[model samples]
Target: MNDKPPFPGDDPFVDSPLVDSHCHLDFPDFQGDLPGLIERARRAGVTRMVTICTRLRQEPAIRAIAEAHEGVFYAAGTHPMQAAEEPMASVDQLVALSAHPKFVGIGETGLDYHYSADSAALQKESLAIHIEAARRTRLPLIIHSRDADADMADILIREHAAGAFGCVMHCYSSGAELARTALDLGFYLSMSGIAAFPRSAEIRAIFAAAPPDRVLVETDAPFLAPPPHRGKRNEPAFVAHTARVGAEVLGMSPRDFAALTSANFDRLFTKAARTAPSRSGRQE
Candidate 1:
């Protein structure tokens, strides 16, 4: 059976330049299709994307993907679910990794009590280390939070209080209180394919309530593929679908919303923005 969902329609924001703020291009799902996947993303007006590395051991491979692709960047950290299984990452080690030009963010790290509640303490410890890395490297913290909103909020609030660090709640589907807390801390909330589901009105409402300037769009590909491609494997190209939904939620045109989120991404991921080449093959 063909699992690929039909494209919604002709592209509406053909001229809009977008960025996939979070994804995992190194995953085996895209093993032999990187070039085609990237071309589709370009055709969808996705000019840049950050491929995240959830485990430190995979950083080399992730870095290579970013290096091989002109518009791709990467971030590395121990994923919360893998906290107990992996060697604890040190702030110094993460800081060292940040020295790469394409290494732009600190983590896809945070709390994931849904599947790994037994490792909550380890996850928290890992999160604190990633937070410190983000602070030291002056890079945005890419957080993956699920079923641990309260602790996530508390830790983020406490960590920020000790010393400020930039962050983005990747695939944010948490409660309003956590959304407010993240926004109050000046962190960005990334809308993933989940936000585009027909049953995601509450998630859409949270985005609607957030400051447009503080919101971003991502695919989190090979995972949550939004409608029109809902049940198929996701890719960076599919981020535009989520962006379209985000545009509707925020009452902006597709092109405008794309530009808005791209700007927001640039603001938070300064390293990527600073070094990313303009479409003309010139430094931006």
Candidate 2:
């Protein structure tokens, strides 16, 4: 459990603070060394992270993680992939969860037609429910779109037209059109380790075309570990690696990109930005 990954000394962004905007800290992958994982992340300049609950039933565990950690926050929703199997989540249930001080966002929810195409209708229904919750909570909707970009964009556009709400397309690797639609709607696009892949030129170009103020960085950890650690399990600490690649893709200094993305995170995940007194009663 003590075999922590070494911090990369030669990494240019080693001193810059970063945020892992999306991850699943409760997953069994890091259960053996959660504390060590957090420490490694901090040492790598990842100062904050948001652990997302993909199923509504797991909200309590996710909430507990945020409650127990100083710089961690949580979001809950029924993942579109599980939409057909999991109990349908009501807007009220999600809004109730937002009452928790650390419940900072609405979802890792959206259409995932890639593997769950059979549940398309149910996924859309679930997505709409989560969107409403985001609107009511004023928390950003964390979307997980894949393969079905047209449907995703259409639903997002229609729902947004009905009422406005903040959102971020997490782990965005969709086409240029959806990226444009999301940006035009004043939503954000989060860069994940996938964008760091050597063959991800198209993905990088999509991000490069996006407004910097609306860009975010995440690990989607326990998955998508960028190069050097690719194929290994991912953790929040690895977000810094992805950030460095993002800087390279955007032609900015790593430090500048880190700062920009962190600022963008604060802007979108506003609840996490407010200074609050920690358990020791000192402002954090």
Highest lDDT among the candidates is held by which one?
A: 1
Candidate 1, residues 1-284, lDDT tens digits: the string is 97656452247674788898999999999999998888888777788999999989989999999888888999999999999999999999999999998999999899999999999999999999999999898999999999998999999899999999999999999899999999999999999999999999999999999999999999999999998878889998888889889999999999899889988888999888876555333456
| Alpha-carbon local distance difference test for all models | 0.90, 0.89
Which candidate number would show the highest TM-score if scored against the true structure? 1
Candidate 1: residue 156 Cα off by (Å): 0.9
Clashing residue pairs for model 1: none
Give candidate 1 misplaced runs (Cα > 4 Å).
1-10, 276-284
Record all residue pairs in model 2 with backbone atoms less than 3 Å apart, i.e. clashing. Answer: none
Candidate 2 C-alpha lDDT tens digits along 10-61: 4557687788899999999988788888877777877788999998898889
| CA displacement after TM-score superposition, residue 264 of candidate 2 (Å) | 0.5
TM-score of each: 0.96, 0.94
Please give the lDDT score at residue 282 for candidate 1.
41
Stretches of candidate 2 exceeding 4 Å from the true structure: 1-6, 9-12, 276-283
Worst 10 residues of 2 by lDDT: 275-284
